[model samples]
Target chain A: MAEVNNVVEALKFMALGMGVVFLFLYILVVLVKVQAALIAKYFPENTPKIPTTPVGNTVEDENRRVAAIIAAVSEFRKNKS
Target chain B: MKLKQIFISLLFAMIALTSMSQATGQDATAPVVAEVSTEKKAYEPKTIAELATSFWQTTGINAIFDVNDGETTSEPKGHAYEREMTWFESSLGRIMMILIVFLLFYLAIAKNFEPLLLIPIAFGGLLANIPLAGMGGEHGMLGIIYNMGIANEFFPLLIFMGVGAMTDFGPLLANPKTALLGGAAQFGIFGSLVGAVMIGFDLQSASAISIIGGADGPTSIFIANRLAPDMLGAIAVAAYSYMALVPVIQPPIMRALTSKAERVIVMKTTRQVHRLEKLIFPIVVLVLSILVLPESTPLIGAFAFGNFAKESGVVDRLSDTMQNALINIVTIFLGLGVGSKLAADKFLVLETMGIMIIGLIAFSAGTAAGVIMAKIMNRFSKEPINPLIGAAGVSAVPMSARVVSKVGSEEKPGNVLLMHAMGPNVAGVIGSAVAAGVLLSIFK
Candidate 1:
């Protein structure tokens, strides 16, 4: 009976220890969730959606026209000279 | 004779032309200069008026002036009630300190220095420090919240329930032996307890002191609330500051104790844990703990209830609620309540500094104890467990686990100890609570 009591006492001590540890753990997870929720609620989503696929030739074509204009101006200037 | 006559005529024509040109030039220039000067002078008053208007619009100080007449008329009624802050004497110092605390909280939250609690805590600190806001003063919102929750010890427990819901026992269950490492890590708590008593703190104060070793904030608050409610402010600040500094605290102790070879020691990956095993684990652990320590029931019971909610699978909605909405609501109140404790008179003291120092000591001791225990376990065990995982035995959770992984990888490239260390890391949470329960029962 004494041995059984000692075992019971030991068990009780273990349980107490486990309980305190778990309690802290429980609070921590709750705190994290709270933070995450706050972030999700307040942070605005404003990312611009860009369609994928290259648009390359248009810029080159514009650049060629500008170059042509510049060349024509220079040619006209030379002819005047 | 003809050349002389032409020269004389040319000189007269030149003189006339020069006089006429001068008169016309002066007439044209004077009007242009006069017009420019007139336009510039006109703009000066308009710009000044615009500046005044913008100043009024931007600051809205005019609104205060507009209401000033009414406020003056009603002033006599609120004169005694409107407790004036000692703004002239303490404003500068208070504002600077508040800014520093705000930055610390921001770093802790925004940069992920324990983001779980720090962000709310930082917000609370900011709210409290606003001059004459009355949030930390008599009849203030924060003051009321603090009295209702922290001083009364309600918020900490509610937070614990949320924590329990979010935590998974799978890692700890798969490796039950790691629980012993968790137990060993708690030496810091007892060591700090002894240190606190030696430093002239009473038993209750010492219990609050020891809890800092766990590197767990809510547990510290829980113990401090019961043990030394007066010291709650100091104990909490110390507990949280140390928790944020865990990455810095654990690595040195780990390096000092273990060799490069030992640090690099890698254990095999954990086996897939069965769901049935996971479900039963919390029950068995809780039952064993409850039977052993009735005093621990509050902490243990709440934790078990949360885990039960998780594992039962039927109460998914309830678990989700606890982990999400319920916890978030409690956190705002808890943070505000806790921040209310940082009143100028209560928080700025010699005792607060002592708590901070003792907190660091407790954390260092906890890390050392964990490493030593793992070394001892390594001697007896055939499984060849890496001692680095032992450092995670402090209840800092993923931070402690990440530290172990970082240090382990530093020793050997591609060595991943994070998942393995998580076993002990999670167990450390359970271990710290058990230790807290023991102290509560013994001291209560």
Candidate 2:
């Protein structure tokens, strides 16, 4: 009788435990979504916008930089034993 | 006058030495021992041979050979602790425990298995088995450590604070639905509890033992110390060992549960969380927990405080200290404190075997549940959720999260589920704490 009671009680405990966890986290999930929406509405971030378009000289400068890196690598490789 | 003064000083010093020598006899003045004949029924050893014999009595080697602790009849003797003579309390048992400690050392050092904790715990076990050392006895060094933080449940709570301070809830907040996986994983705890109960352990011991499935060490220790302190040693060892072996234990189970197609599914990257949202999260969690279950406050409160401190940005110093210095210091004591419980009489029992076997069952069940939960979520949701990430819901923290990512990558090269998995991993921490709270409220 006691062993049966033990199993039954354990099942009840398991249900309560699993139920509470799911309830708590599920609420948090909804709350999180709500919190996200509310924050988006009120406390919007001041994101500094970057200029997407490259300047005219950047392409030529990039070429020069790549050439300099190549020259430096060749020089270092040539110096190596 | 100078010679008279010097003679007087010498006479005073001689008198003091004679009295001191009578008590300790280290000074070896034979006349004092003879003069105090009536007082000295227990004569101090005078000869070198006698001294050696007395010294041997105090040594570990002699303690091993002594039958004073009543090894036979399973008789309760000498503070109700003794070697079983056949099992772990025997001299052979002590040596075996030492060798086991050596294996722990090898695992920690060579195999890189949770070295920060295992090293201290292994060392404490070493100190414990050293006969006559009494390292695990009342007022002994390890005993003091055990009583100081572990016994009162301070160390695990403080560790929770450190874990909280370091936790980033951004991923969890980004994809909140994954929290269900965390909750589902806790089935491991409940499932194991039932198994333990069925196997003749009482409710409290079963509850404490089952908590190891949560795969959160501090939470396991907190619950075990509270519910079933007698089983603390075995439960803790099982908790830590399985946690360290997360990679080894979790992967095969994960593979068995999920199809290759499910493993290869890619998850959406998490959205950026606002600083305000981050700051409010811990507060919301704390308030909700306090309202619902006051029992979980010790674990959750510390965790919430840690997360709040980190999010506040104003309390960087406090947060940094909690994360680094405070946590490091607590880890050392906590490791030793847990290790103090690894005394042979406590650890090498039938219950330890029971705890280990059931602990594995709990852990496997949790992993399978998490994966299955993820599959269920996929059926209901528009976005494809990789079932592999569900296995991380046991909250071994970054370890289980990393395992998910590794497993996912195995299915599809360059696949990343780490951030996605973190959602459930973090939730598992909360989920386990909630389960712990429920258990405490009922069984405590």
Candidate 3:
């Protein structure tokens, strides 16, 4: 009878302890999920903004560069003469 | 003629008075002088031979030999074995303990079994049993260290702080359900508590001894110091020993609990945890711990504080200090402090035997419980949870996690479970702390 009582007592404590741990962990799970959801909804990940125009050399840019170089060279020759 | 006669008379009178005064003084000193002379005659000065005998006694050589300073300085009847019989009487137990400490040294050095702790503990044990060394007694160095660290729970908490700084809780955060495995594994603690109580230990002692199942050495030391200080050495040894043996102990039980299919069930890789989530996790745990079990706040709070420091990105220096310098310093002292308790008289007791047996049971039960719980969880869950990862819930940290991975990889060569096992591995840490808190609350 005494041994049985000790076992019963142990079981009671075990149940309460395990229950409390489960309850606390379950709450943690819920809060973590909610936090993830809320953060995902309100503060989405920031994607880097990409420019639409081509970054490589284009025909217009090449023509402008040639024009500027020719005008500077002719001006320099006129000043020298 | 008159002057000469007066002078002669005065001289005669002076000589008589001097003589009378001398006689009176001698009468007063006679008794005292006689007593002094009698005492002096009674005490004879020791000769060179007698002096040698006294020196041998001081050097403890008298234990094996007897010396005499008689007329011829003859040898006494005392033989090597007969003189210090008491000293040699229990040489067997002491020698055995010394051998045991040497074995501990071998385990630590060759096998690399928790060397950080075992080395100092083994050395301390060696120093403790030296005949007449008094290292484990009051006023001794080891004794002072024990009083400072282990006796008051200072060293263990500091170690916890360091452990917290080193731990990355992102794994547990990534998969919250694995936290239940940590909780489930604590069954080993409570179950063993019952076993201990049934074995005739008191409730408090049973609680302390059973916590060895939790597989956290500092927590074991902390709880033992609080509830059953007398059993601290045994419980600590058992806890760390089992933790070191996790690779050996957990696998067999883990293999038995789950089938090969369950073992190879591939768990999805956990999502990346945000820095914000990592920062908030410790604070939330600290607050919730206080609310649930205030008794556990010291341990949980220190651990959480360490984790927050590490994750906050502002105190990198402090975090580094906690992880390396501070933790290393505390570990040395904590190891020595625990070793001080391994005195022959204190450690070689009936309770020590019970603690060893119960400790193994607690660890095995914990591993079994964790794996069994994972199997049950898999029954309802859509995601197939690998049962091997569940054994990591015994809280041996990365060691248990590694074991889980190794065992799983054995079944399916490409199936790696290390990352998945880490989830329950970290959870087991928190779960053990919570379980310790529960025990402390009930006992307190």
Candidate 4:
């Protein structure tokens, strides 16, 4: 029984190639996960993320803020004049 | 219409074709032939008719029409064909080849398909087909550059280096599970290998052609040069052309394989990757590649060096060079070197057709395989994974990633998958390198 040598060889390449690619990448996944863990544990960033600024809770505060903005603009304009 | 009526334009075209390559093929081409007339000293033309006749005989039209002209060792400018072609074969082949070059230019310009490489390659091909020029022959300029870079395997490795230098592996480092999608996409290469063998190509050529599934032009050229140098032109053209068409080819396969719900699935971004982790990444990959598959070391080593230079932060100048100037220069030479193989004898064969068809099938199969693999992963995955991102695993780089993102968002508004697709996109690059190594280990 003479099987075509090309087919046999091609089948070998397919199996080995797919197997190696999967195996290599699989190991890489594990390594990257481990490396991420090691890095997070050993050397973390110094400053934590900044929190969003909290807004004041009343209408009086909003009015005062607007008046301050207008006063600052007018005072700057008077100084320039 | 042509059978009954005399076509004036067709007759003129035929007449035009003959006059182009015959100028140096006959008459005054050889000293002995000119001296055959013993009556006149030095064979001088006494009459104007005699002078015109001699001049006309030297025209390309005469050479093309002369079917059984006596053998000459060298072409008009001393370029000899290694495979002795007849006057008709040589001249006719060049004519057909110039037409093919025009189509390549059209694809690059009008169609906007891979213009950067295609323009240079088409120009090289245009020069290669000039009658009796032998610009693509061994001693010619294009041929010398071809030997210096492509033949020795440095050009592809250098390209991989540029790719690595520019690639951001943070997305891949953040999500390791997506690496499986990259590995799964390589099934297209192996699967295409079987199909190519069945289609009557030898094992070496089949392997070279199948690498087109990787969708990375440099790797395809590298393997083609190694395993099947004769088919390099066809494989490179097919690989680059199909890659440009990825945005067109991938979506249909991806849609067919995945359900709407799977496509719409939203994935959560992984935690931030540390700078140290990023720095060590290329070294780990390089070391591992050498340990497991030394055959892949050249590709992987160059890629790692480029990434390391970028990550080191101190060598911004070197990194800048690798990613820009060096890569651009290599690309021009690489394109022309590949185009040198577009000589009519190599390109006009039936095998080129087989390579184009196989390349298309391989690309589609790779996209489908990646999608299927992602669907499987979603079943086991605790976090919801969108199957669309898996289609980016064929290593078309940012192109496939962008397409995946576009396709994913088309299903569900505001469902961004570009960053997520990048994880598998980069993984596919490494996966294909490993696959190429395996193929080399088996054959070499």
Candidate 5:
């Protein structure tokens, strides 16, 4: 009976140890968060400006135009040569 | 005219000499031919007497007579040869099973059922199933690769390093309270342990069984390999399958536990993390985790080391090697090795089904626990908290975060929970690793 009780106590301690370790990790994360918040507040950098126009369409259009222009220029050079 | 005639005649003589030489060479190489005076005929047995005396009698009494001859005959070939060929006799069955695996791969890759991992996994499966390809056989290429990594637990740990390199711990550090949810979510790990033990699995088998709840493949494989290498195939398949099915498995439980309003609650944007804080974070976590749970040091240590390399900014070469070259090489070996485990004899069993079913149970329980813990925390907390982010507590990394975002946006489109969800998302990685360590220490 004493041996059984000892085993149970050991398991409990094990669980408790895990819980304590988890609590410590949680505290560390909170400390990092608080520190980051303070630093950000102290040094306020410019927010990235968002362009109003949609992204993929404009990029695709630019690429197409550039390709056409390069083709025309190459043809002109070929004719001259 | 006389000279032209002489040249033509010389050409003719040259052609005749060449033809004669070629004929002689062909005759020398030809098989010895014998002429028969009469054509040989097959013996036609019109009666029992004729059949009994025929050359067919050489096959023994079984081949001596037809059924119409009124004689019971025994087969000349023994049963041993038939028994030996029984495994190949079911060619259709083997082909069908291979087709099923191929279809699953197709669904996984083409239909985007975890394409990043499954595409390569599916290709590996197809390669292994090729008849006599010997990918799964002893001395085979895939067999050698599998033995080199999967059996030794090298591939999975290397994968963890790559995962560590890719992960940005900034979100996790930006909102620490989410770590509680990560811890709470690990109830599934214990739940699985109890369930497995109840089913008569030993401590080591139970440990492998329970890691399915971690909802992370490398962690599951690592723990499984350490605790119970015999159960590696089942545990790995369960882990990868459930990971692919996360979007399907998690939503219902997420909906059941939290109200629509709770899901829609917007979390505050995380503040910018400092460079110094980012640099010190992995070191602090590693040291603390090791001090508390020394058993978890291997996984936690490797993870922290990889992250340290990434965050330090000075070890760009080491980080790059871990992220690209090492990871790519490991992925190929791991996929083929894992596929090699899917051999017909070992994989085709009821235990495989049990592993998959229990894996789903573990995932659901983890998700539910995280949500409930979040709601409980929300009751006491001053700041607004989104319970949906709790679902990201599983260590599926960006996928779990993406699921939270998708679900949260469905309730409130403008509510961006991805960054906030990332806190618990990363924390879940640590939580599972810790749980894996606990299991390893207790079992090993």
Candidate 6:
């Protein structure tokens, strides 16, 4: 019976409580979003690029791997013959 | 003259002999002294029947046996059977509770449902129910542990510290709008509040119980301890059980609220958060929380302090200790203390059933609110937000986030929503704590 009497008050609390939480979070979101945008604008992210070797050196490594594979295959054919 | 002297000596000798004879006659008859004796009583062993009766009486099995008195004893008046025993010592409810404890154990072990917490709580429930064990009494070990931590709100706050230490705010920083999803989920708390009050629970108890919707166990325990200590056990259990069941409970509501295409929507990768943003995040939140709701300081302060310590990078040892040793120890004692409240007299009631029903409603309502809030957000934004990620806004942490990922993957195999889901997941933690503060502002 007492709870029935207080239902109106509890509903009010529910509205107010949910409203406050939403308001607080909305403010927090705006603050964080603004801060993030500002930070990104002022300090653009800088990722260091990996150093590339000369094209001749890069080709030399790949050619060596290819040569090793070819030589293993030829040796196998000779042994079979 | 010689004859007269001999006659006198003979007469004197005769007189001496007679005197000696009379003295010997008097000494011959000695007086008698009476002797006192003590007799031992005979021992009589009790009959076998009598011994059995005594055993049953001593062991408190008489309540079950309907033995009111000794052999010739009749049942107590106003009852068909024995009625003198306390409900605590003997009741059918105790058996029902034992079965419930076993169910919890099965859920913890077989179902892999929050095993770290459920296992201890189930064992504690088992300990609390054993007849004559007094484990849940004021002087019992459980009672001491409860007083040491749970009663004073120490263990839950420490757990918040651990949670703060482990949490990374980078995802939330990358997508700040998801905080609204967190806020929307708090609808569960308020919705359950109305339900409880309508169901006849007092405002204080309803507030304590409704916080279960927030999906944060520590905050629930904290509020329950403050406003409704009597219902703390049921509230804590309901809060954790629903949290464990989040994977099962949230998906249907989430699916019902969102379209399949929305589930398949892939979110943009979160922006790379900078160190300065990470350091300032906890401080800003802490300051705002304290300024708005000082009653929330104990919880929010400990959480922010822990986050600051972790983000500072200068206190590796302290952060490690809070995240590991300190939290684990607190968890064990806290689980046991909560389980102590499962005594039949305390938990086997109409109110417990109400809390269980209301708590489920709270979780479902929160999940729906978050998903729906996301769909509404999509209406105004150019970027399509996967409404599935909003379901993670109930603060069940990685579990809720994983559920989001699972649902999304089921819709589209290559979709990865786990990191994106974490934005609202962590925000839900903050939102729930804030809701707790709002409730505290009223009830405290």
Model 6, range B266-304, lDDT digits (tens) per residue? 666555577778888998889888778888888888899
> Which sections of candidate 6 miss by over 4 Å?
A1-4, A37-81, B1-55, B58-89
lDDT of 5: 0.68
lDDT of 2 by residue, B45-95 (tens): 466443444444454554575535433311112346533444347566677
Model 5: per-residue lDDT, tens digit, B59-153?
22211122122211111122222211124212332454467577768768677877666656656655554543345554666667776887677
Counting clashing residue pairs in each candidate, in order, gives 14, 1, 0, 9, 0, 0
**Could you give me the TM-score of model 3 versus the true structure?**
0.78
Worst 10 residues of 5 chain B by lDDT: B67-76
Error of 5 at B121 (Å): 2.8
* DockQ scores for all predicted structures: 0.05, 0.27, 0.13, 0.27, 0.10, 0.22
Q: Write the per-residue lDDT of candidate 3 for residues B1-444, one digit (tens) a residue.
A: 999977865554454445445546767754321111223355668554334433433332222222221101001111221222233323444566678889999999999998998998888777766544456655667777887777788888898898888888777777788888888888899999889888888778888999998899999999998999878888988898889899889999999988877887766545656667778889888888888889888888889988899889799899889888999998888887787666665677779999999999999999999999999989989777998887988888779988998898799765667767877888888888998898888877
Highest-lDDT candidate: 2
lDDT of 4 by residue, B1-444 (tens): 775444644454454445333434554454422322427456443454334444544555544544344433222123444656656445676678778899989988998988988988888777665544566666777777787888898899999998888887877887889999999999889999988998898888889999999998988988998999888889998999898898899999999998888888867644456778879999999989989999999988998999888888899889889888998999999889888877776687789999999999999888989999999999999788899988999999878998998998789765668778888999999998999898888789
Candidates arranged by lDDT, highest first: 2, 4, 6, 3, 5, 1
lDDT of 6: 0.79
CAPRI quality of model 4 = acceptable
TM-score on 0 to 1 scale for chain A of candidate 6: 0.51
The C-alpha stretches of model 3 lying farther than 4 A from their native spots are: A1-4, A46-81, B1-90
| Model 1 docking grade | incorrect
